[model samples]
Target: MNFVCDRVAVTDAVGIVQKAVASRSTLPVLEGILIKASEGRVVLTGNDLEIGIECVIAADVSAPGKVVVNSNLFGTAVRKMTGDTITVKMLPNNAVSIKCGNSEIKLNGINAEEFPEIPKFETEFDIVLSQREFKSLIRHTIFAVGTNEAKLILTGCLLEASGNNVNMVAVDGFRLALKKVVTEESSVSGYFGDVSLVIPAKTLRELNNIIVDRDDKIIIKCSQKNVRFEFDNVVFTSRLLEGDFIEYKKIIPTEFKTKITADLKSLIEAVDRASIIITNEINKSPLIMKISGGEIRILCETGAGAVDEVVPVEMTGADIEIGFNNKYLLEALKAAEGDRVNLDFIGPINPCLITPYEGDDFKFIVLPVRLRTDVSMDV
Candidate 1:
């Protein structure tokens, strides 16, 4: 393959596809990126069986050919090169030469025929949404996905579509995050139906990074087996996990005994500071939150020391004291966009539901830690 392209465009495409390249795979071809140059465009693809990414760059193509080159080496060399243009040419000895400015590097290349072919969906149900909206939804929920391999389904995010709305949910047994947005149109022809598919969190995160700044609308096409995301010059495909997502709504409490509103920045900083001291203990010490009389106090203690912060809040219902992992709380709080956030606690042991005071679309449920009474206590 021979093509000349902008360094920035090639670098971005390489970085994105590299995310899907297998780091340690028995199949050597899976570790390399497949480059297809034809019809005045260059296509880059990387796949590790579960997830695959394809990116197209507008290039001046002199020859039509395809080759697979080591993704890591290619990405590193391209990034280090100083030039506005990158020229890649396939040689007769099954090797590829990358030339930029005064530097030229020759790398061993594999036959494109040996690369695994990614499946293409024939019949697809499509949904349309802006890049920012889709990216935000993934970021808000992907962090809560389970990482355990044993629970394969939990490691993926649930994508459900009904009528004109799409919802994404992720949980790791201990916590759950659900985010939804309404769209004006959907090409999915059904009776306001919902398709529940578990998409790997890693794929979702990678997709988010690639489409972060893309303002154009994205087309999400899905079959029963794989999900495809297509935009300007990129296409992402991920294998769907075959399993029923736990009925997450059943676990979310409908009501709460106490609801408190506090500044998101203040709460995040307090929890972060408390976590520093709490990590010293054996049991992974938890942060305690006591809400009473228009004030909320957060406390945590360990072998090193303890920290306490009091922040004023607008609260109602009975007073409640709760314990939770400071890290979990901080993550949920980081998703809070507004200055004030509302926390709903049913009891000291039950999961706490957090949301922005005026927004009802995003919800975060964090399971509380078992309160330890041995610590120095203050009400």
Candidate 2:
């Protein structure tokens, strides 16, 4: 491959594709980035057998060819190149030469033929949504995706589409998070009436990073087996997890014994402070919430000491006390949107449901932790 591309373009392309380069792999080809130059455009591709990313960069290609270069080395060289533009030329013996300004570097390139072929889809795009909306859904629920590999399906976020509405749901057995949004239009048509996909959290996180400006649009195409995301000049493909996601609808509590509305920022701050000393203990202690007299008091006791903070809240129905794993609560709070959030409690032992005070677009549920014997509650 021989191409003259802007230094910034090369650097960005390498950076984008490197996200898919396998960090530890038995196959060396999976550790390299494929560079294809043809018809005045240069394409970069990387695949680790799970997810693959390919993007095109505008370049002047005097010679059309393809080469596989070490992702780590090529990425570093592109970033450290000392010129506004760089020329990449594939030498005769599978060696590659990079020239930038007065600097010269040569590296052995892998044979492109050895790289695994990334999956390709033939169907038309099934769903179209704004990049901002797609990103919002991911950020809201990705944290709840189960990291436990044994529970296979829970390791991914469930993506479902019906008519013009799209929903992303994730759970880690201990907690559940749901983010729903309606697109301006959708072309989702299938035999099941609705399309469902379980996309791994790792893929969604990378997709989130690539969707740059909010104004951009994303075209999503999915089959029974794989899904494709096309945006900008990049195409992303991932294998879908097999099997149905847990019947999550039955998991959300429909009724509450007590509902408390509190300032989102204030509640987060109080919980964060209360959790400061509750770390790495064998007890795996929880932060306590006592709701009474229109106020919520957060307290935590640990080997270090105790923290107690009170934040005013608007409460109705009944007063309640609850226990929750501080880490899970903090993650959900950080992912939640808006200035005010509502917490619904059925009882001290039931899951605590959290949602925006004004809308149902986002909902989070964290199962309560056991109230430790050493801690006393005023309930």
Candidate 3:
């Protein structure tokens, strides 16, 4: 494509689309970015079969055409350019020339026709949410998405939109994270019901990185197999995972026998200190919490060392002792929005539910680690 574009704008667009470029693909074109110059604008697209990202930037299009250039080479060339504007042109024999100031770089370009097309969806529903809200939703829930390939469904987070509410749920067998928010707007075609999509966590994570925290709204369009996110001058599309997500609602316990209101920062700090004794993953130790009266005692004993700390809390119901993976509990606590949080415990073996002191915007369920009483083990 022949286009003269603002160097900064093109550099930003290249950086955004490069996230979707296939790092190691059998198809050479998939490793390159498709640039389409048309009518005063340049469109850049990157697709890796699973997720695709497109960015549009205003440019002076001298000759409207399209070309596929290596993403790394083109991006680096444009970013290092010292001029205010960059000139890109298609040369003979599928070669692309980039010029800025005195620097010129020529790259072998693949025919645009070889690049795979991003899926076009006949959208059945659309949900509108603020950039800040959507970004927060992904950050809160993505940590719990499963990494196991055997359970494919758990690898993605469930996205549900109904009424004016949007909910995201993720589970990794050991823990579950749920975040709900009120949407700016939601609409659907007559044939479709409320939007229910299991979006791959990886796609959402990438989208989160691109999204800025603003009051500006993001439009999400959902189809049968794919979902599209449109905001500003960018469009993001991803193939949805095919399978039934876990019924997370049923998995969350409604009743608890023990509840404690603890300072979120304090609890997190205590957990962090206790986990310091766990030097390696091979023999990692759990953070043990003994809650009673108005205080909670944190303890950890590992082959490396032992830690003992305390965090005062407001407790009710029966006192309980619980053990949990240090990382899991710390992540859940960090994801919480408020300063104080409530932790609900069913017993030592059951899951621990964490929620904010006030609103129900988020909920986290972390399963307790079972402590083994071995003769050689010390508490």
Judged by lDDT, which candidate is best? 3
Number of backbone collisions per candidate, in order?
A: 0, 0, 0
Give per-residue CA lDDT, model 1, range 1-379, as digits (tens): 7889999899999998998999878888999999999988999999888788899999999998999999999999899999999999999866999999999999998999998888887645676777877887898898799989999999999988777777889999889999887766762443346655678888888888788755588877878888888887889988888878899989989888998999888888878888888655466878889899999898887887989988899999999888888878888888767888999989887899998789688899999877756334433
**Cα lDDT tens digits for candidate 3, 145-264:** 999999998999998887777889999999999999986455333334677889998899899989999988888888878999999999999999988999899989989999999999
TM-score of each: 0.92, 0.95, 0.96
Runs with alpha carbons beyond 4 Å of true place in candidate 2: 187-192, 373-379
Scored against the true structure, residue 334 in model 2 reaches a CA lDDT of 95
Candidate 1 least-lDDT 10 residues: 187-196
Question: Once model 2 is optimally superposed onto the true structure by TM-score, how far is the C-alpha of residue 282 displaced, in angstroms?
Answer: 3.8
Lowest-lDDT window of 10 residues in candidate 2? Answer: 370-379
User: Which segments of candidate 1 are over 4 A away from where they belong?
Assistant: 24-26, 187-192, 373-379
Clashing pairs in 1: none
Between prediction 1 and prediction 2, the one with superior TM-score is: 2
Cα lDDT tens digits for candidate 2, 85-181: 9999999877789999988889898888888889876753377788998999899999999999999999999998888889999999999999999
